[model samples]
Target: MLGRMGRPGLIGLAARTAVVAGTATAVSGGIASHQANKANQAAEAQAWEAQQQQAAMNAAAAQAVAAQQAAAPAPQATAGGGSDLMAQLNQLAQLHAQGILSDEEFAAGKAKLLA
Candidate 1:
């Protein structure tokens, strides 16, 4: 029954403190790193979802445009006045001159008008 003291030595206390501080620092750093990784993953997932939503919207808009074009009514022509036909031909000629329509396209338009 021969023991030293009520408290540990100064060097023993310093060693213990260092061990505790180091362990605390290491655990806190690990937790912070984990949280950052989780946040990064969440942000990336949000960005990916946004991109998918944008793509879907773009597709829907394109479909809407196609549908609108398909549902549009053709111009009505005057039977004997020939005014409407001339206007249509003039429009085709203008489109061809603007390079919006090719030579074959202009020919097709002219044929359709005459027919």
Candidate 2:
């Protein structure tokens, strides 16, 4: 071994080949692991974004429903053919002012009250 310098012997050659193969395997494994971690992180981020979007859409839908509910007409105090005609007309006017009733509906109610 002390006088061998021109080329590696069979044992040395085998040792070198093993070292190179081990290093290549380790490096390739490390690269594969890194790429897998990156892919997993990207997938998680996309899922999080999708969840946020769904939550926003749900919130908007809830707000619209709340607005609709707020705009709906309240139940009348008395049934049909009741004696409080003035009260009914006042209620219709209030609903119109609050934008709950359309213009045509307001006119129809007033005409019905007068009739």
Listed in order, each prediction's TM-score against the native is: 0.60, 0.63
lDDT of 2 by residue, 11-110 (tens): 9999999999999999999999999999999999999999999888666655654475468664355666465777768877886787656687678868
Give the distance in Å from residue 49's predicted Cα in candidate 2 to where it truly belongs: 0.3
lDDT of 1 by residue, 1-115 (tens): 9867789889989999999999999999999999999999999999999999988866665565446436756667656858867877787688668765557767876896688
In model 2, the worst 10-residue window by lDDT is 60-69
Clashing residue pair totals per candidate (backbone < 3 A): 0, 0
TM-score of 1: 0.60
Q: In model 2, what lDDT does residue 30 have?
A: 100
Instruction: Score candidate 2 by lDDT.
Output: 0.77
